[model samples]
Target: MNILFYNDSQDQLFHISPRQRRVALAVALIMAFLTLAALFFAGTKLPVMSAFFPVLGAWGVMGDVLTSFILFNQFRSSRIFPLLLLACTFLLTGILSLFYLLSLTGMLPLSGLFASGSQTAVWLWCFWHSCFPLGILLFMGSLHFNKKIIDRRLLPRYLFSGTTAVLLIGVLLLALATAGQDKLPVLIEDGNYRRLIETAVGPAIWALCALASVCSVFPYKKRGVLRVWLSVAVFAFLLGVTLSLAAGERYTLGWYGARIDSLIASTVVLLSIISEVNKLFVRLRRQHEELEESQQALESANEQLKELSGIDSLTRIANRRKFDEVLKQELNAPQRAKEHLSLLMIDIDFFKAYNDHYGHLGGDMVLRSVAPRLEAEALAHFGFTARYGGEEFAIILPGHSELEAEQIAELMLESVRSLAIPHQYSDVSDQITISIGGCTLRPGEKSNAHDFIGRADEALYRAKHEGRARFVFANSARDSCLHPFETTSH
Candidate 1:
């Protein structure tokens, strides 16, 4: 039922659409221009060759195209889109690497120079250097959007743990790559060997990033600021690695310049992915919260309904329905143990005539007053009481003998008499009074609840017939009999 998904931090940054795509394109274009201008200016000022610029521009454009495709696809579907995008991206990278290798070894003459042994080294340096700033930008952008993308998927806990581990490894790898580049002279001779070593750094870092991307497919229940922080960490590590490799010194003048441009384009693409991820995470979180709230509401409603179903609306006591249930439970145990069980049926005397005189409202007040007295007295001697019907109430006394039940009935009569409520048109005395009929099931009495109730009803009839405001005990003998008496009428 819930439609909105959000993260713990309440950040809603990732939502890729045509508008975002346009923005990304605009940013990519701007970065591309900046990279080109930097390359041209550097070439004019420094003794950098012009031939490598074209190759650098080509790689930059290709990287931008591939990244755009991947970013757009991710918004459409997480299940197949990311995988397809990654596959296409990896293929493009591989092709670019092959082309670069060909250009370096003199088999390809795109630059119009037999790539001198030095030229190949220079090309590697140029490629990474150009890519450095762009990679950092892309990584930052991805970090910004990681939350959205994470929200879109049900990532597993282990995947998040693995991502953290991979992110850590990426950080270490970046550090190592930077150290290697900084100590380029000691690590390798300043030629093609150094360039090859630098190239290895990018692929190694990319492998770590790829692992992280794959892990995103698994469910990770992480939320809030933690997701943001994790994303930032991964992006930073990747950015550091990319920049380290791209900013190295041992490249051909033209080749070095071109790599810088390509790096900028790649960076933009990665940033797009991050933005998408963030939006997805936000949506997921909102949905989760809504679902939890709905479930709680449903449970509370069910509990209330259960309570309402068991309670009597009139007197706020357990109704006849509840009485039946309680009786069944008590009877089962008492019957098994052959224990004595007593039932008292009490009714307001002359209730019909009282209603005729004072109206239903006054009668209701009288009933409410009389009902609680019966309940209190029953609970004092017996165990439970219930409003059995209009103007009628019942109490269950477990393990009570016939004599004990009669005593309890007497107590109920006394309690009702103490209320001092007036009843003018009664056939009994001048005050409000009640008639109670009680019957006790002796040990080994093999009858259902109906028989016990029938006997109590008979005794109540006898109490009313003799006079109101008295207690009547139903005889357990075969013949219908009752010892009834009036205690106090007023």
Candidate 2:
């Protein structure tokens, strides 16, 4: 199963499950309740914690850096613009956090490299919080604006120019906040000062960020994996902002809770990316198994086809084509001269008359019956057999002399007659009979397959002319009665 699938061509869409959307919604609801409670306690001050800002600032820098790097890697796979924006958004937040920490610690502007004051850290915090939601708002809305996939050739240009633009914007904002902190209205409500968020600016910023988060998780719309998680992230950031500046007081319960909300914002998207990686591994493993099974099935089919191509369908013996191929291979083999090769040809007697009387079906039965006996006797002598043509068969006896070849041929003659199948049309006997002719010769460098087969075929013609059922060897003549085993069934 494809566990998660992003629309690589579309900037802000993917296929997602109901469970994922439900989980995002759950986080939004839980955070919303907590944020409301924190706002209720916003005006109430708590014990001042000096380490709170430093701890949160360090975490924000590290967390946003990790989150941005992951999204940047994801953007490479899809070439989507929203992914790039999300990456840059995280990067901006991370850099702003770093500067805020450095300025607050009095570690920045080392050796007068830059300038900062007591208000620099608070303004940096304002810019960081403000840009994060704005970036996310653009990311979700760009779903309609950027529909086509960016070409690979144009990716570098987009990356460089886009990154350059964000960097410049961040630099200008840093300069405004740091070198000119006195001119701008202070955001932090320290001592007798008032918070900017508590006045007319409060409702506008909250409404806009809340709208962006709420729209992303619209119940009727399809919220994909990335969008769902990002929706959760933005809502968490909304909660942080709500808790931090709505009361305009430091060391309040909401002030501490805002840092926790910021952490949730960075973690949610990282969780989504991790889920994607795990599913990809599972998909690759399944594909590997399928590929192995397909390979085995193909190999098995090839073996069956190879066997079928060489086998005779009717008689269950090797076909004439297979016989020709085997003979040529053995004759031309490098080790052929080390032993003798024997070719024996057999023919049924008066087979035309038998078929004319019994019809072709009966004739087929006789041929099938005769083929097995020939094969059995040939195999007993360590020989190979094939059906040469209609009413004819051949055998090859490797490492056999003319005496061994003749003995095997004679045994085949007796075996066929012993079947006791009635012929009724043969001149030789009341039962079917066959003529055998064989030749045994050591294979030489110049040996040809046709010459070896023809020598045996010549002997078979002589055997048929001499008698209907008899054995003949090409090299010499022998009287059948002279052998100890003689059959008179034919």
Candidate whose lDDT is highest: 2
In model 1, what lDDT does residue 358 have? Answer: 96
**Top candidate when judged by TM-score against the true structure:** 2
lDDT by residue for model 2 (269-306), tens: 87776786677788889999999998899689657744
Candidate 1 C-alpha lDDT tens digits along 1-490 = 0111243322222422455445544644554455445443332324455456556545654654565355334433442222323323333342434344454444543332232233443343334332333333343344345434434444444234433543453334333333333444332344323343455654654556545533432233332222232233233334333433444433443335445534553444355455556667888899999999988996896577547657777787778988887777677774636778888888888889999999999999987888888888777875678889899998999888887777777777767878888888887657787888878777877667788789889988887777657767787442222222332321
> Where is model 2 poorest over a 10-residue stretch in terms of lDDT?
481-490
Q: What is residue 470's positional error in candidate 1, in angstroms?
A: 1.7
The alpha-carbon deviation from the true structure for residue 354 of candidate 2, after best TM-score superposition, in angstroms, is 31
Global local distance difference test of model 1 = 0.55
Candidate 1, 397: how far from true, in Å?
0.8
- Give the clash count for each candidate: 44, 0
